[model samples]
Target: MLIGEVARRSGVSARMLRHYDSLGLVRPTGRTEAGYREYSREDIRRIFHIESLRSLGLSLREVGQALDNPEFAPSELVDDLVERTRERIAGETELLARLRRIGAVGPADWEDVLRIVALLQALGSESVGQRQRAALSSVEDVPVPVEALVEAALNETDPNVAGALRWALARTGDGGLALLAEGLGSPAAEVRKRAVESIARIPNGAATALLQESLTDPDVPVRRSAALALGARGVADAVPTLVEMVVEGTNDVDAADALTVLARDSALAEQIATRLVACLADGTMESSARRRLTQALAEIPGNTASHALADLSHDDDRAVALTATYIAKLRNAQ
Candidate 1:
C-alpha cells in the first residue's frame, strides 16, 4: 500500500504517517518507480501497533521505545500510565464539580463568575487564613453555592476554618443539609463529626430532624454531637446519649448543660431527673461517673431532682456526696 492508502485504511493521517517515518517509527518497506514511499504489509501492521499504543496514552517517544526495545519492560510503564490516567480523571472530575457549582449559582456575568471562582479558590487554599476568610465571607459576600460550602466544611481540618464553614453553611439555611447529611455517612470519622457539627449550627426544623436521626449514628462522636445539638433544641430524644456522655466524661460538661436545657420543661424535667437517678443507682457505674451524674441532676429542678439529690447527698462516694449536698443546700436556700 502507498502512503495515502495506508493512511486511509489505518486511520492514521498521511502527515502523521510521514512524521512517524521521519522519526524512524515506521519506515516504508519499499519504493515505487516514481520514488514515492510504499508500505509492505508488515509496515502497515506496525502503524496499527503504534496507533494502539497511543490509545493507551503512550507518548510518541514511549511508543517508539515500546515497539523497538526488546528488553523494555512494560509493567512499570503500564502502571505509570494507569496512575497518570487516574490523576487526569481526578482533575477532570474536580473541574466538572467546580463548573456545576458555578452554574448552580446562576452567575449574572463574568464578574459574578470570577467572584465565585475566587471564593472557591480561597476555600481550598493551602493557607488556613485564606480558607477561614473564604468560609466566613462566602455567604455574605457572593452567595457561594451551598454545596461548595458543605464540601469545604466536611473536609476542613483546622478548627477555626471548620467552624467558619459551619457558620457559613448554617447561614445558607437548610440548603446544605442534604449534602451534610451525606457526610454523616462518610467512612471518615472526622467527616461524619464535621457533618453533625455543621448541622448542629443550623437552627431549623429540618436540621433538628436530621440531628434526631443522627442520634443513633454508629460513630460515637457523631452520636454525641447530634445529642448535644438536640439537647440544645430541647429535644428529649437526646437524653440517653447525654446521660451516656456524662457517664463517659466525654464533653460531660456540655452534655450536662444540654440536659439542663432540655429539663426546662416541667414534665420533661421530672423524666430527666428520673433517668439520671436511675443511672446513679446502677451498680456497675464508677465513682467518677456517679459524681458526674449527681452533678447533672443538681441542675434539674422539682421534687424528683430534689429527692434524688437528697438521696445522693449521703452516698458512699465522698465527692458525689459533697457535690449533691452542696447543691441541695443551694436549692433549699433559694
Candidate 2:
C-alpha cells in the first residue's frame, strides 16, 4: 500500500507515518517507478504495532525499542505504564475535585474564582500559620465554601488549625454538617473521631441531632465525644453514655461534670441519680469503677442520690464504703 492508503486504512495520519519513517521506526519496504514510498504487508504490520504500543502510553522511542529489541521485556514497562496511568488518573481526579469546589463557591467572576482558589490552596498549605489564617479569613471577605472548611477540619491535625477550621465551619452554620456526617461514617477511626469532634463544635439542632445518632458509634472515643457535647447542650439523651463513661473511667471526671450540668433540672437530677445508683449496684462493676460511680453521685442533688450514697456507705468494699461515707457526710453538711 502507498502512504495515503496505509494512512486511511490504519488510521495513522500520513504526517505521523512520515515522521515514523524519518525516525526509522517504520520505513517503507519498497518504492514505485515515480519514486513514491510504498509500504509492504510487513511494513503496514509494523505501523499497526507502533500505534498499538502508543495507545498504551509508550513514547515513540519506547515503541521503537519494543518493536525492534528482541530482549526488551514488557513486564517492567507494562508495570511502569500502569503506575503512570494511575498517577494521571489521580491528578485528574484531584483537578476535578478542585473544580467542583470552586464551582461550589458560586463565584461571581474570574476574580472571585481566583480568590476562592487561593483561599483553598492556603487552607491546604503546609504552614500551620497559613492554614489557620486561611481558616480564620474564610468566613470574611470572600467566604470559603463550607465544603472546603469541613474538609480542612476533618483532615487538620494541628490543634490550633483544626480549632480555627471548626470555628469557621460552625460560623458557616449547618451547611457543612452533611459532609461532616459522612465523615462520621468513615471506616477510619481517626476520621470518625474528627468528624464527631467537628460536629460537636457546631451548636445547631442538626449537629446535635447527628451527635445524638453518633452516641451509638462503634468507636468508643467517638461515642464519648458525642456524649460530652450532647451533655453540655442539656440533652438528657446522653445520660446513659455519660453513666458508662463514669463506670469505664474514661474521661470519667469530665463525664461526671457533664452529668452535674444535666442534673440542674429537678427531674433530670432524679433520673441521673437513678442511673448512677443502678450502675453502682451492678455486680459486674469492679470496685474501682464503683468508687468512681460513688464520687460521681456526690454531684447529684436529690433524694435518690443521697439514699444511694447512704446505702453504699455500708458496702462490702471498705474503700467504697469510706468514699461513700465521705460523700454522704458532705451531702449532709450541705
Candidate 3:
C-alpha cells in the first residue's frame, strides 16, 4: 500500500505517516519505481500500533520507545498513563464545576464572569485571609453561587474562614441546604460536623428540618452540633441530645443554655426537668455529670424543676448538694 492508501485505510493521515517516517518511528518497507514511499503489510501494522498507543495518551517519543525498546515494561507505562488520565479527568471535572458555578451566578458580562472566577479562586486559595475575604465579599460584592459557599464551608479547616463561609451561606437562605444535607452523609466525621454547623447557622425552616434529621447522626460532634442548633431554634426534639451533652460533658454549657431556651414553654420546662431529674437519679452518672445536669435543671422554671432542685439541694453527693443548694437559694430569692 502507498502512503495515501495507508492513510485512507489506517485513518493515519499521509502527512502524519511521513512525519512518523522522518522520526524513524515507522518507515515504509519499500519504494515504487517513481521513488514514492510504499508501505508493506508489516509497516501498516506498525502504523496501527502507533495510533493505538497515541489513543492512550502516549507521546510520539514514548510511542516509539514502546514499539522499539524490547526492554521496556508496558506495565509501568500503563500505570503512568492511568495516573495521567486520572489527573486530566480531575482537572476537567474541576473546570466543569467552576463553569457551572459561574453560570449559576448569571454573570451579565465578561467583567462579571471574571469577577466571579477571581472570587471562586480566592475561595480555594491557600491563604486563609484570602479565603475569608472571599467568603465575606461573596454576599456583599456579587452574590456567589451558594453551592460554592457550601463546598467551601464543608472543606474549610480554618475556624475564622469556616465561620465566614457559614455566615455567607446563612444569607443565601435555603439554597445550600440540600447540598449541606448531602454532606451530612459524608464518611468523614469532620465533613459531617461542618455540614451540621453550616446548617445550624441558617435560620430557616429547611435548615431546622435538616438539623432535626441530623440529630441521629452517628458522629457525636455532628449530633451535638445539630442538637445545639435545634435547641436554639426552639425545636423540642433536641431535648434528648441536649440531655446527653450534659451527661457527657461535651459542650454541656451551650447545651444547657439551649435547653433553657427550649424550656421557656411551660410544658417543655416540665418535660426537661423530668428528664434532668431522671439523669440525676441514675447512679451510673458521674458526680460531674450529675453536677452539669443539676446546673441545666436549675435554669428550667416550673413546679417540676423547682421541686427537683429542692430535692437535689439535700442530695448525698456534697458537690451536687452544695451546687444545688446554692441554686435553690438563688431560686428562693427570685
- Choose the strongest candidate by TM-score: 3
Candidate 2: 10-residue stretch with minimal lDDT:
138-147
Q: Candidates' TM-scores?
A: 0.95, 0.89, 0.96
**Candidate 2 — which residues are off by over 4 angstroms?**
282-288, 311-334
The residue ranges of model 1 lying beyond 4 angstroms of the native Cα positions read 138-140
The better candidate by TM-score, 1 or 3, is 3
Ranking by TM-score: 3, 1, 2
Q: lDDT tens string, model 1, 1-334?
A: 8999998898999999999999999999999999999999999989989999999999999999999999999999999999999999999999999999999999989999999999999999999999988988845568688889999999999999998888888787888888988987898988898998999998889889988988888889889999999999999999999999999999999999999999999999998999999998899999999999998987898899999889888988889999999999999999
lDDT of 3 by residue, 1-334 (tens): 8889898999888889899999999998999999999999899889989989999999999999999999999999999999999999999999999999999889889988989999999999999999999999946567698889999999999999999999999888888999999998899999999999998887888888889998888888888898999999899999999999999999899999999999999899999999999989898889999999989987899998888888888899999999999998998899
Note the Cα lDDT for every prediction shown.
0.92, 0.91, 0.91
Model 1 whole-model lDDT (C-alpha atoms): 0.92
Kindly give the stretch of ten consecutive residues in candidate 3 with the minimal lDDT sum.
138-147
- What's the count of clashing pairs in each model shown? 0, 0, 0
Q: What's the distance in Å from true for residue 105, model 2?
A: 1.1
TM-score: model 2 vs. ground truth: 0.89
Q: What is the lDDT, from 0 to 100, of the residue 148 in candidate 1?
A: 93
